[model samples]
Target: MASAVSENPFGRSITTEDIVDTLGFFDSWEDRYKYIIDLGKELPAMPDELKTEDRLIRGCQSQVWLEPSEQDGYFEFQADSDAFIVKGLLGVILSAYNHKRAGEILDFDIDSYFDELDLMRHLSPTRGNGLRAMVQRIREIAGE
Candidate 1:
């Protein structure tokens, strides 16, 4: 049988640099938020069949699912969220982590990236926690 991971053929072409540059162009947080939501809108829809229980992210306030696979030492993740902002947050995280080599993903300074985006301060405590949870999970997967 073909692996479930093969079913997604997932790709996240956006980069963290693109997000920082775009977010910088916005003069206000509201505009930045709109851009973020738009980014979420661009994410290819994760099919409902892939949104299985084992894929669900545990710490998020909204329902989030992630399907991960490794091919030739690079990781590809297909993820979805029930909330718009959460989806946007997933976009940010995926932009950094998806399709990256395990070493690359593990080496990335995610906190610094978040600081450059000025992200965590703008988020609610719960949301911030969820974002961290997502990162931690991805990092864990990479470490394995």
Candidate 2:
């Protein structure tokens, strides 16, 4: 069984609230995008072995790998994307859903959360679709 780092790369702990607050601090969308990419940079590396086709997420314009594990009844996910911005998006998704129980994850209003972040409107159609696909994949895993 593989385990992931509890903390993101920056040493400081990251949480969904923290991302929301930080994103709110930036006035321009350009700045926000940069911030998101920075967050992506902070995501820990996924082992090459874990990047198999079975772990590849479909619908993304870039290649994405997701591997999930349950620990003590909570789910933890490890993900990586070939594109910088996509990786950042993965970081955002992980912040919202990681270390949560299946019921909790199911209960989460992801659309509302994305609305609060003002995220979806800015994304390209393909990216938006891919995002939904990733969420759906995670939900399916949790359901199982």
Candidate 3:
């Protein structure tokens, strides 16, 4: 398995509360978008070696790769995307799911979080579906 480092920070230093509060600070959607993109920049670099066909998430308009590592009960995920906004979306999702236990991942009310972020209202239909797809994929992994 590939080791995780700066490639992910969610559920560690970057909590869901942090994301929510930071997003709430912005008055304009434009600024919020920039913040989301900046979060994407924090993803570090995902190795090309790990971006395999099997790791590619299905139903995304853009190509997204997700890989998970779990030990005992804790879980962490490393994900990457071709689109900048999609990468940001991954960061938002990871903020909830990554580095959490299976139960925590499964129990997180992602819809409420997104609602709090006012995310779905600003997203395109395809982007909304893609976001749901990413969440679904992670949820399946945690279920296993």
- lDDT, candidate 3, 20-50, per-residue tens: 8899898999999999998888986899999
| Residues 29-125 of candidate 2: C-alpha lDDT, one tens digit per residue | 9999999999889988999999999999999889999999887777888899999999999888887778777877787788887998999999999
What lDDT score goes with residue 125 in model 1? 97
Which pairs of residues clash in candidate 2, taking residues 3 or more apart in a chain or in different chains? none
TM-score winner: 3
Question: Residue 128 lDDT in model 2?
Answer: 98
Model 3 clash pairs? none
Model 1, span 1-144: residue lDDT tens: 101111123443778888888999999999999988888888879999999999988899999999888887779888899999999888888888877778788888999999999999999999999999999989999999
Clash counts for all predictions: 0, 0, 0
TM-score of 1: 0.90
Candidate 2 TM-score over all chains jointly: 0.90
Q: Of models 1 and 3, which has the larger lDDT? A: 3
Between 2 and 3, whose lDDT is larger? 3
The candidate that achieves the highest lDDT relative to the unseen native structure: 3
lDDT at 56, model 2? 95
**Local distance difference test, per candidate?**
0.85, 0.85, 0.86
Better candidate by TM-score, 1 or 3 = 3
Candidate 1 Cα lDDT to native: 0.85
